[model samples]
Target chain A: MTKTSAGKPFPWHILFFLGPGLLIYFSVSVYPLLDTLRLSFFHESSDGSLAFAGLANFTKLLFDVVWSEPFWNATWNNLVFFFIHMLVQNPIGLLLAVLLSSPKLRLSGTYRTLIFMPTMLSVVIIGFVWQLLLSPLWGITENFMWNLGLEDYFDAWLGKESSALVTLAFISVWQFVGIPMMLIYAALLSIPDELSDASVVDGANPWQAFFYIKLPLILPTIGMVSILTFVANFNAFELVYTIKGALAGPNYSTDIMGTLFYRTFFGFQLQEGSLTMGAAVATLMFLVILLGVALYLFFFQRRIKRFQL
Target chain B: MKNTQMQKATKTIATLAAGFALASTSFSAFSADKLVIESWRAEDTKIWSDIIIPAFNKSNPDIEVVFAPVPTSSYDSALNAKLKAGTAGDLITCRPFDVSLSLYNKGNLTSLNDLPGLASFSDVARSAWITDDGKNTFCLPMASVIHGYIYNKEIFKELKLEVPKTESDFFKVLATIKSESRYTPLVMGTADQWEAATMGYQNFGPNYWKGEQGRKNVISGQEKLSDSQYVKTFEHLAKWAPYMGRSYQSQKYSDSQNLFTLGRGAIYPAGSWEINGFNAQADFEFGAFYPPVPEGQDTCYISDHTDIAMGLNANSKNKKSAKVFLNWMASSEFAELYSNQLPGFFSLSKHAIDLKDPVAQEFLSWRGQCKQTIRNSYQILSRGEPNLENVLWNTSVGVLNGTMTPKEAADKTQASLVNWYKPQQ
Candidate 1:
C-alpha cells in the first residue's frame, strides 16, 4: 500500500471536480461572511471613509441606548419568533408527516402537494394575500368571522401591536412548514417497513410501533429540522419587510433581527444606514445562529441516536 | 464514453467562460453627449422615457439622456455606493433635505447655484435643495407635493356639506358623514404609518405650528416638539381617531387609497401625488381643500413640500449637456408639460403655468393663498438615531390608534430628538 501510494500521483481528478464549486462558494458566501466580520471592526470616520476602530462598532451596538434598545428588542423578538416556529410549525409538520405516512391514506400525494403549495409560492405574494385577507378595511376576514358568529372576537390581527409579531410568525410558519414536513416525511418513509411489521406481528399496535420504532428512527431528522428552523427564523426578513415595511410599525411591534439588520444596513426613510452598525448586527446574528447550531450539533445530535434502519 | 463526456463538458465550460469574459468587458460604446441621470423614481420609468426624455431630445437632438432609476427604497445607499465607486450618472435626482445635503457634503453633488433659470424659483421652492446657511443651492428644485384633503364631491353634495373653512367645520362635516352616511369620514391608515404622519399630521399640523417659522424654530431649539403647538397638533390627530373608519389601526396606505378610490370614503387626506391616481380610479368627481385652520388662528399654512429635484454629479464628464438638460427642467415649457403630465406634482419653477388639469390647478392656486412649509421632521432634525421623521410616523400612528395620548406622543418624539440632536440637547 505504501509503495502504491508513493507510485501514484495526487488525486488530480478530485481537485478538478471540487475546484469550481469551492471557488464559487469562497467568492460568494465565505468571502462575504469574512468581509462582514472584518467590517464590524471598522467604522465610518469623519471623512466618510472606512477606518479601523477595533470593537468600537460592536461596543456601540451592544451598549449605546439608541442602538442597544433596538438590538435587544430585535434579538428578543427573534427568539420568540424561533420559539413560535419550534412550537407550532414543527409539531404540525410532524403530525402531518405521521398521518401521511400512515397506512391506507388515500390521495396522500395530493394532500402532501396541497399542504406544501404555500412553501413553493413567493413570500411577497403570500404576504400580500394574507394582508388583504386580514385588512380591516378589506373586511373579508371580518365578514367571514361574522358569518361564523365569531364577529365579536375579530380584530385586525396584522395591525394590532399586541398581535402583529405573533401574526407575522404564524404567516412565516404557514409558508415554510412544508420544508420540515417533507424532511420528516422522507425520514419516516426511509424507516424499514419490516421493523414495523415485526412489531405488529408481536401484537403491538401501529401507535406502539410508531412510538418505539419510527419515532426513534426520525429523531435525528427532527433535530436537524429544528436547527434549520432556528437558523431560518433568525434570518427571516422578507415576509416582515413585505407586510410591515422597514419600520415594522404599530410602534415597531414586529421588528425582528432581520428587519433591524436591514434598517441598519440600508437606512429606512429618515434614518441614515451605517455600514459598521449593520455589520455588527450581522455579526451578532451570526454568533446567535452559530451558538444555536453548536448547541444542537454537540448536545442534541450526540444525545439523539441515528439508528441504522 | 464517460471520459469523453467529461472532456466535452470541460471544453464547453471553457468556451462559456471566455464568452462571458468578453461580454462583460464593456457595457457599450457611447457618444460623448450620452448622459445618464440616476434617479429613484423607478415608477416614473415610463414617464421619463416616453414623455420627458423625448421632449428633451426635441430641443437638444444631439444629446442622449437615459433616465436610470433604481427602486425608491434603495436609492440613497445605491447612490452612495455608485458615487464611491466613481460610477454614478451625470445627473442625480435629489431626495428632499438631509439625504441630498449629506450627498453634497460628501462632494458627491456639485453646486448648481449658477445654473440658468434657477433664479426663477421662489425661496420656498428652492428651500429643500439649498444649504442651511441659505447660501448654496446644490440642486434645481423640480417638484413639490402639496398636502390637503381630497374630498368626494358627491359625498359632500349628498351630506349637504359645504367645503369646510375652519377646524370646527371640518369636524362638523366628519360628524355629519359619520352619522348620516355609510361612507368613511376619513380614509387614511396607521398600518403603513407614513400616511398618518404625511397626510394627517403634516397636512393639519403646519397651521398649528405656523409653517416655516415654527419648523425653523424647532430646528434652532427656540421651540421644542413637546411645546404646546406640537402637542396641540397631536391632540388634533387624536381627534381624527374617531373620524377614521373602523379598524383604521390595521388599515394600510394602499388599503386607504383603495377604499377612497372605491368611493367608500368621503375624504382622503392627500399629497398632490395622489391626484393622478385618484383621477384615474375614482368614477365620481373629487375636489381638494387645504387643511382647515384652528378656530383662533388666522394665518393659514400648507405643507407644499418640495419632493424631488435634479443635481449635477460632481464627477460627471459631460457637464455642459447635463446642465442644459437641468436648465430645461427649470424652464416654463418643461414646467407646463411636467405639471400637465403629472398633475399632482406641481412644478417649483416661477413661471405661471397654464395647468391643463383643473384639479391640479385648484391645488396649485393654494400657492398664492397659504404660507408654505415642508414636513416638520425633515431638514436637519432626522440626521441622528431615532430619526425624527420615523419617530413622528410612529407617534402619529400611536396617537391616531388611541394607544398614545397627545402629550405622550409629543414627549416620545421630543425625547428621541433631545437624545441625539445637539440643538435639542
Candidate 2:
C-alpha cells in the first residue's frame, strides 16, 4: 500500500506502441541523414578510392576555383529563384485569395479550382507546355500577339541569357501560385465573417478593413507560405533541367544549386561522375535548408505567433 | 488447438517453398544459356529483337539472346550502378571512347584482343575501344555515323544550286537561298548546344583541323586550340549564324528537324544518323553532302565518328554464349543485315556490303573519297575538368549566338584545356 508508482511494474506497452514507428524513423530518416554527413567528410583520392579526409571536401567545394565558381553561381541563382517567388508569386496569390474569399462572390469555387490547377500538374509537363507556347518556331505566342496587335513585343525570352533565368522563375511562379493561393484562401475562410463585418460597421472601407483586420489575422499563414516557398525554390531542379538541360545553358545562366549538384554528382556526358562530390553538394543543400528553417523559427516564426487569431 | 494451427501454417509454408523450387528449376531448364545484351539504343530494340537475335538463333538453337535496352541519356549512370551491383547484362554495349576505356581499366570489361572477328575492322574503327598503348581492344566496333549536311533535293533544284564543295561556294549557295526568301538557308540551332558543336563545328571543322593529325596533335600538346586552324574553325562556325533560321538562338533540335522535313529549309547540317528519319518524314527527295571544305584546301577529312560498340562483361554468367553472339556481330552477315536495317548507322567492319538507302549510300561513298577520323575531343583530352566536349559545345554556341568572337571562343576553349590537361598545361 505504501509502494510509490515509480516502483510499480514498468509499462511494457509503451515500448510495444512505439517499436515500429521508431524503428522505421531511425532507418529511413535518421540513418540517411547521418550517412550523408559521414560521406561528406570523405573525399575521392587520385586512385578513385574514397578516403576519410576531414573537411577537405567542404574546402574544395567552397574554395577550389573550378568547383567554387559553379557552386557560388548556383547559390546566387537559387536566391534569385526564391526572391522571385516571394515578390511575385506570394502577393498575386494573396490578392487572388482575398478576391475569392469575398462574401457572395460569383463562381468563387470555379475561380479557385482553375487557379489551383497548375500546381497539381507535373512540373515537366508545365515546362514543356510553356516552352512550346513561347517558342518562335511554333509562332503560337507571336501569332496570339499579332492578333492582339502586340506582335512587336514578342521576343525569344527563354533563349537569351539575360532573360532565361527570370523567364524560368516566372514560369515556376505561374505553376506554383496555386499553393499559396489555396493556403491563404483557407486561412481567410477560417476568419469568422463577423470579424471583417464588424470592421465594415465601424465605417472602414473594404480595403481599409482588410488591412486593419483580416490581413493581420492571416500573417501566420503568410509566414508559413514564405518558408515553404524558400524551401521549394532552393530544391527546384526539374523545370530548368527539362527546359534548358543540365548545362543550364545560354552560358549556364539558368544554372541553380540543384542542377549543379546533379552535374557534379551524376557527371554530365563528358564529365565523369564522382559520388563523394555529389554527396558533399547534397550535404550543403541540407545545411542551407536547415539554416533557413532555423532563421525562420528564431525570428519570423516567433513574430508570426503574436498575430495568430 | 494452437499447436495444430501452427503445424498447419508450417505445412503450407513448406509446400510453397517446394513449389517455388520446382518452378525455378523448370524455368531455368526451359531457357538454357540465356544471354542479355544491355544497350543505350532503346530505339533499335525492334531491329535487335525482330531481326538480329533471330538470325543468330537460327544457327545456334541452344542459346537465347535477349536485347535489353535502357534510354540513351541514363545509360552510363544505370550501367555503372548495375555493374557495381553485379546485375548488368552479359554483353555490355560500349560508347566509343573514354567510357569503355575506363571500364577496361576498372576490370569491368574483359579484353577482346583474342576475339577472331575483330580483324575485319581497321585500326581507326578499333581505336575507339583500344587501350592507350594500343595493345588491347575491349569492345567490338559496331558502327559509325558520318557527319555531313542532308539537303532538300527539291529546294536545291528549285534554287538551281549545286552541292557546294568549298566554304565560299557554300556561302554563295546560302546567299542565293536567302535572296530567294522562300526557304531557310541553314537549319540549325543553339538551344540544345550540341548541334552548334557537332553539326556546326565538327561538321565543317574536320577539313580545317586535318582530322586525325590535328586531333592527335592537340592531345600530345603539339598544337593548341588558339592555333590558326582552330581559330579558323570557329570563324567559319560563327559565320553560320547569319545563314541559320529565324530565332535560331532558341530553335531546338526538334524544331530544326521539323523545318527541314516540312521542306521549309534548304540545307540541314546533319549527321548521317538522320537518314532514316528524313527518308520516312520528308515528302521531297533529299541527299547529303560532306561539310564544305575551306578555300584552297585540296584534301578533305570527314568525322567518321565511331558511335556504337559491344564488349564482354567481366562478371557475365553466360560468357560462352555471349562470345558466340559477339562473333556473329562481327561476321559479314550481321554487318549486311545491320547496315540495311539501320541505314544511317554504317557497319564499322571492312566488309563491302550493298546499301539500298540512297542517302546512306551517298554518305558511305565519302568513306572512299575522303580521309576519315573520329571527333577530336572523344579521347584523352576530355578526361579532365572543364571537359573539352562540354566546353566545345558552349563555345560553339557562344560563337553562333554572337556572344563570343571567334578569337574569344578560341581563347576560352584553350584556357579550359590548359587548366587541367597536363599536355596543354
Q: Give one digit per residue, the lDDT tens place, for model 1 in A97-157.
A: 9999887899999999999999999999999999988877765888998999999998988
DockQ of 2: 0.54
Whole-model Cα lDDT of every candidate shown, in order: 0.89, 0.89
The DockQ values of the predictions, listed in order, are 0.65, 0.54
Residue range B254-369, candidate 2, lDDT tens digits:
89999999999999999988887787789999999998888888888999999999999998877778888889999999999999988999998999899999889999899899
For model 2, the superposed segments whose C-alpha errors exceed 4 Å read: A1-23, A45-48, A307-309, B1-33
Give residue A221's lDDT in candidate 1 (0 to 100).
91
Cα lDDT of model 2 by residue, A3-82, tens digit: 76657877889999998999999999999889988888887753456789898888989998778888999999899989
Q: TM-score each candidate.
A: 0.94, 0.94
